[model samples]
Target: MMNYERLQSNINAYKKTGEILEAARFLIHQFNLDDENFAGFGFREELEKESILLTANGEIGEMQHVMIPKNIFDFDLTLVLNMLAHEMLHVRQKSPRMMILDKNEREWQAYYEMLFHTNFPQIPELSDYYKNFFGEKALIYYSRMGEGSELQLKYLEQKLEVEKFLQDIKNKTI
Candidate 1:
């Protein structure tokens, strides 16, 4: 069973930093990623950027541990969790040859699973591209990486379908 109370606590603890740290640890566990396989040892700097970034160096589909910036928890909790799912999935990539198919398929699967499997929580932001743009972004990223394949049609179709789905839900709620 999904633990809404626990998630709320992890994302909204008394100390914002503590909440984020808890959420990161919780998400790492949620995705079956190791808490210790990766490291976050840098001292907190007065970074002016909106947030920190993570880089995972490897061939496509190869699995890797990702470093999470502690600063990410400063964003909207739901948004940060969605971002966490996307960036961590980036830590595991497919080869360049299958980049188009693999990235889209994996991201779509991961996003739907993470969001819906959690029962859509009560966070409104979870319903939008802020949380559901994995497949869409995959299309943009991979198409730019290559000469742009015939799959552009399918990618566009998928993106349209998801957007329409979101819009339909919004309409029904209204």
Candidate 2:
């Protein structure tokens, strides 16, 4: 059973955290994103010491769990908002199919979306962390993308265009 009150409180907290995510979704919808693209995305916020989780196979917004340090509530709201957007993107793209793709692609899309929609900078440590954890390939790709290299941006743009095209086709068929 779900706790409706708790869920409502989290939604309210998220609104307080930042409304940019809402705005981003509005923009996506305004552009006519296929419904299947976000069929399983949802958000949740709870008082936690330090932890964030994303289920790559769940419905968008279906996973009702995100725990941030209680101290986060007092820190920069932008940071919280950025994290929320990042996690939400994870939820939006969750699927067994996504799991089969390069993990770096997943991270790249989330970070790219967050950076594109919000004021978050591409932190050096984050790039370094990915490099350390995933190796040179991820590092090179992430750095190129983060630096706004035309080639990398073009790749991302092309990928998004393809996704939109496929989605449009799906919508028409449905």
Candidate 3:
């Protein structure tokens, strides 16, 4: 299905740059993604939406392409890894009949998954970096879902669950 050689080659090409290779490797291992379904990934200056920081494309729940902002390399490695992790979560959601998750629901899941590793007690430095930096971003992003009625309530529930999970990590209960 997947051409491991080509994927490894492509990932290796980013070794001289920031931690892009490491970030990709971490997600690949974390998700246990198939080689073929992975489609492929790249950094490009040309993206369909100028406002889009990154993009992930897939068909029937399998990731086909991931186009990242070339300038993302200029940021902190943790942020870059976090962004990649978020997009990959979207790619992961596509298959198995494309479960109909709402936009905020999907965003909550992606942000939660992206920040899940921050709970690891073994990697305190990484945990701290993510908690200090990206953790607030997650809160801010999900906060937008707290607006109006029934649908918003469901979104808020998801946001609260993620908040509690992060809090548990902060308290070292997890």
Candidate 4:
């Protein structure tokens, strides 16, 4: 197992300049997440051509590189925390096949968790999007541990189909 003390020390060094990294550690502990293969947390000034606001790569249960685009720091703390929570949810999704769910399903689950459960202030647009898609009661029903999970998966599939249709139309219009 990795030495958490050393990790905390490293994260402490960033407290002065890298609030995001410190927040990452805080979220990890808050969520009681497993980050055994989590390699390191930092920011990149220059990102790849197709990079996301936050990015990670590498095999499951092995060293994984997780980073944030430096520009993301310019955004609101809630947005930053939301983004970090979304990515950390991915860390919890490890399975024998690397990921138990498809991309869209994983994203849906992550968004639902971040928006409804993380206790972080949500971006209104995102919360509205979820509400529009799943409605408030349905979101609450699906957010629970063992309740409505199967139905949530069913709803997720239908939501993905609708999203794909919308995306296709947008592409056509463009």
Candidate 5:
């Protein structure tokens, strides 16, 4: 298991001046989420403690999400990008009255979007998009822990996806 201290250290050590910008570029080029400023991607110490389930709250970029930490505790650029992509999906999925009624479909689509960049072509106002669905107060919650969990498969899928996506991003950056 990866310790939090070591993982956090890894992120700090692999630091860059334009992590935010790079992330934005990544979303734009790879995910086709052409936003000039990735204002939605926020980071904090507390965030590392929350998974995507606890991170989302019917708010668009309002949630301070850990973004990339999985069970591995590694903080490489890939992990950071992976985390950002993961949270971006949540941000993309934000609806005011979001519900668990379609968790599987949402997650399935989210996973696919993260991997293949087949997401919404443009960024929309999260609040407005979900104002009627989940509202500002009604947060939809789901985890890979219940009867719906294909945890291992999802993990593998994300791992492969991140790896490939990161490589593609690397090719562009290089």
Candidate 6:
């Protein structure tokens, strides 16, 4: 179960920073990500464009590093959560050690998982954007991952269970 008290504490801690942190926390729990394995260090504001990158050098999915500009923090909390979840999915795939796969492939997998798993209803909008830019083939690939295979269904069912649990907690709070 997710530690709601701890999540609430973290939310309070990042109150001055903005709601992005809280959204990230919700995603962390929703995905069952281990905070110990993933690190959110070096969140200092940058003047340049806001971006999040996954570094596979030292910790091969053991640590998550995020960089966000101060200006864009409040503009889009969902975008920030999506970026954080995207990187965390890379961490889940253990992509850092796999040298044969290119960054694009890794990103595709992360994006696919995020779109399929997250409860956030804005996924269609995000998927449309990706399909527009990266071509419909990628989106088609993601949607087709379950045509004849039971594995994708099982995975999605588990994701739905977790998401439902998180939603239950959110509802109780309300």
Pick the TM-score winner: 3
Residue lDDT tens for model 2, 1-174: 124355335545655767534533442343333234344333445445554333334443344233333344443333444555555556545543344244455566665554344322332123323223323333344555545665456466644543454455456656
Q: Please, what is the whole-model Cα lDDT of each candidate in the order they appear? A: 0.49, 0.44, 0.56, 0.53, 0.40, 0.47
What does the lDDT come to for candidate 6?
Answer: 0.47
Worst 10 residues of 5 by lDDT: 132-141
Q: What is candidate 4's CA lDDT for residue 28?
A: 56
Q: Local error of candidate 4 at 122, Å?
A: 12
- Assess the local accuracy of residue 30 in candidate 5 as a C-alpha lDDT between 0 and 100: 52
Local lDDT at 163 for model 4: 52
Positional deviation of residue 135's Cα in model 6 after best superposition, in angstroms: 6.2
- Candidate achieving higher lDDT, 1 or 6: 1
Give the TM-score (vs. native) of candidate 6.
Answer: 0.44
- Expressed as tens digits, the lDDT of each residue in 39-100 for candidate 3 is 66776674443233776665645555776665554455445556666666666565455553
Query: Candidate 5: lDDT over CA atoms?
Result: 0.40
Per residue, candidate 1 scores C-alpha lDDT tens digits across 1-174 of 247567656566634655545566666565454422244222234355565554433455444445556566566665655555544545533433334345545555445434444322432346454433443554454355345465445456655655666566667657
Q: What's the TM-score of every candidate structure?
A: 0.51, 0.36, 0.54, 0.49, 0.34, 0.44
Off by over 4 Å in 3: 1-14, 17-37, 46-52, 58-63, 70-79, 117-129, 146-148, 155-158, 161-174
Worst lDDT window (10 residues) for model 1? 35-44
Q: Which stretches of candidate 2 lie over 4 Å from their true place?
A: 1-64, 95-100, 118-174
TM-score of model 3 vs. true structure:
0.54
Clashes of 2: 8
TM-score of 4: 0.49
Cα displacement (angstroms), candidate 4, residue 49, comes to 16
lDDT score, candidate 4: 0.53
